[model samples]
Target: MTTKPAINLWSSSDHAAEYLSRAESVPHRTEGESALLEFIPPSTRRILDLGTGDGRLLALVKGELSERLRSEGTSPRVEAVAVDFSPAMLEAAARRFAGDPSVTIKIHNLDYPLPDLGKFDAVVSCFAIHHVTHERKRALYAEIYSLLNPGGVFCNLEHVASPTERLHDEMLSHLDKTPETEDPSNKLLDVETQLQWLQEIGFADVDCHWKWREFALLAGRVGAS
Candidate 1:
């Protein structure tokens, strides 16, 4: 088997900095993220965020849940684990959630199998996971399936492979980037393959819920029964 390229950019400060700078500028990201949020069942109590860069998506989900609980006159406690291997990203996420006892930031490399963090009601990842090899990605999906409680959901907002070389180039151009400028860490796979992997791993209702060009929101649920 061919060895996968190491995700060097994730560990480098310059790469992390550049991504953080442009994080919010990715067009249509918010729309996909919003759609992902809507798919999460309201009764989620424990959530896990893989590759939680600066805890951005976690913060958004927490804020929304808090509001929902307040409006319903019910106190819903949410425990979240934010995992990232990048020192810079871990520090940024730690700082972002400092003094918030509900969140825990852990340094975890997704290239390997997940640690025993206990089961969660929902698991989320955003603009991450594409850095790992395709083989690792499939294994990780199976791991994620095992980590979820019954009826739990997994939502991944990912950068996926384009259908053709021309389309890939067009996507890069649309993002004002070139292949030479793209992150070497990216080992993007097609949406169909990922969704099929999820289904094969025993995640029910697997589907790509939303997509815009190369970005997609893939989700699945562990069966309740």
Candidate 2:
């Protein structure tokens, strides 16, 4: 007898469409996004956004950088690369960034090794990495570390596992979702293990920067310049 694979509906057009409709309303999402942006410095020249759904967070970050540049009355060039695997999501992001010469959108899955896209000053992901298996999550963290330049930062506005099933259910309830209705693609893991993995892998200043229920920001620096 053979066991079937886990269901990941993100690749489905309907699922991707459904998510885009509710993407803005996730509890404290803006707060999380705001906190994630603070870590990225204005001096960053290259950015990589992983699992960049519809390029929303990527756009926000770029916008913030632009605002900063405007305030300083100096314009510095910033280039961004956004990656996602779902065909529907890829199209959405490409369309979202269409005619924007600064952003380059690519299609790539998080379950596999990342493509050779050189290095980035900052790497970011928003609630997208938990879909991969727990083992792969650690490996991906390592890969992200390798892809960063010294003094670079990695910011992840992530969905993490609760300490108990009861808390997990409560979190879902707060989001107006139940176990039966929740996305089967989620493979949540505890924060401690992930932080430990980051430290063990040689990251500096690693921590869960902010959190609300299951939504948290995991950030780490590559090294001091």
Candidate 3:
């Protein structure tokens, strides 16, 4: 007997477009995004957004950092890289960041290792990353750790696995989605396992900053070496 290959429907333009249409409607997503932003260091000058669908979370981080800088009477400047593999998502991100010279959009699948994009002061993702295989998830966390500047932060507002099947069903109901209707691309991992991975990867202050059902904000800071 052979195991079937795992499915990832995000490559389909229709699937990607459909998700974008309802992206803002996910329950408690804004709250998670807000919590994720709070973990970003106010001094961050360079940021990278992984799986940056439509560049929503990246835009929020950039805006928040700019506000922090302005309040300190310093020049507000942030250079960003937004990455996504889906053609539809990449196009959306491109249009969203169009005319903003500070934001660079890159195409890369999360299943493979990340390209050399240099170090960043902050790295973020939202409702993404969970699409990768469990092994890839751990490897990606390690890669993220290696990409950070010392004292840099990683914030992932993600769709995490629930502790129990009943709870998972309940959460799905809250989102008006049945298990059968859930995204085939999702490969949710439990929060504790992921937090442990970050800690093992040498991240400091590893914690789940916020959570609402399956949605969670996991964050950590790289130590100054």
Top TM-score prediction, candidate number? 1
Compared with the true structure, what per-residue lDDT tens digits does model 1 show for residues 144-190? Answer: 99999999999999999998999999989888899999878888899
- For residue 28, give model 2's deviation from the true position in Å: 0.8
Error of 3 at 183 (Å): 1.2
**TM-scores for every candidate against the unseen true structure:** 0.97, 0.96, 0.96
TM-score of 1: 0.97
lDDT of 2 at 195: 92
- Give the CA lDDT, 0 to 100, for residue 178 in model 2: 100
Any runs in candidate 2 off by more than 4 Å, and if so which?
1-6
**Arrange candidates by lDDT, highest first: which order?**
1, 2, 3
In model 1, the Cα lDDT at residue 73 comes to: 94
**RMSD to truth, every model:** 1.4, 2.5, 2.1
Tens digits of per-residue lDDT for model 3, 1-225: 121246788878998888888888878888998898889988899999999988989999999988888888998678999999999999999999889999999999998999999999999999888888888889999999999999999999999998899999999898888989977677888999999999998999999989988899999999999
Backbone clashes for every candidate come to 0, 0, 0
Model 2 lDDT per residue over 67-93, tens place: 999899988888999999899998999
Clashing pairs in 1: none
Q: Each model's C-alpha lDDT?
A: 0.90, 0.90, 0.90
> What's the lDDT for residue 48 in model 1?
96
